[model samples]
Target: MCARIASPCVGLCSTTLGDSVCRGCQRTDDEISEWMALPAEQRDSRMVELDGLRERVAGRFLRIDDEARLEAQLKRHRIRFRPEQPPLSRAVELLRVGRDRIRDLQCYGLVPLEGAVGLTAAELHERLSARLLEEASRRRRALQACTDSHC
Candidate 1:
């Protein structure tokens, strides 16, 4: 049996706030609305695309020292995450859900790197979230353009 594909919703959907791309999950507004009707394969494919972008952006700021430990921490703290998600990308979920509460990055099996240094957890989360939304929006527009042209 195929494993259930998890929705990326963080329960802080900015799409309701009129953003083209949700700052919470980074999904385009249309994707959010159509999520339930999307077939499993399409959901998985879209998840892979989202995970890839998350890892690309989050990797710029953090590194996973141990996936197992990170998973443990996430569960201990009750952070929502998909088991199928790349552990590195799960870092984004952690930052979003626990930004204000997280005190030490090392405890979560993450090492702050690059732009993450010298920033509070909230600050880091904001920067990462902003970048993710920006990229997702750009990608959505590109896809829309392609569709508009029948590419």
Candidate 2:
């Protein structure tokens, strides 16, 4: 009688922008590239390694339940010496920096920020759009200023 084959993975390999994984086995692109040359034992070992990595990734999410408590604590502490909000002129510069970081996150396919400091995918896109608008306005103002001086 033929033996039934064991399944390679769960449905957790949904994202594969930088990796390859079927339901049974998933690996980084570099690992997948060398998979054919690896001995079966080596492949098995890699699967074990991957399982550990997957668990770490899935378990590392920030706890949303604690967010409110943390915010409340900060508000109660009333940290002194808060600066006033910057004028509109400075918003562009701040947005530009934020957009750059967002782009880096998107390009890397993962935000490297610890905990909830990193923007979510939707938030990153929104920040980029806002930055683009800010940049356009800044350029327009600069051009108008230059024209006024020259004319």
Model number with the top lDDT: 1
Residue-level lDDT of model 2, residues 1-151, one tens digit each, is 9543222333334236432333223343444456667777886665555444433332343222343332333344432211321112122222223333334332322323355356654453344444433443444466578888995
**Clashes per candidate (backbone, < 3 Å):** 0, 3
Span of ten consecutive residues with least summed lDDT in model 2: 80-89
Model 1 score (lDDT)? 0.89
Pull out the clashing pairs in model 2: 8-24, 9-23, 9-24
Q: Name the lDDT value of residue 107 in candidate 1.
A: 88
Candidate 1, which segments miss by more than 4 Å at Cα?
A: 1-5
The residue-level lDDT of candidate 1 at 21 comes to 91
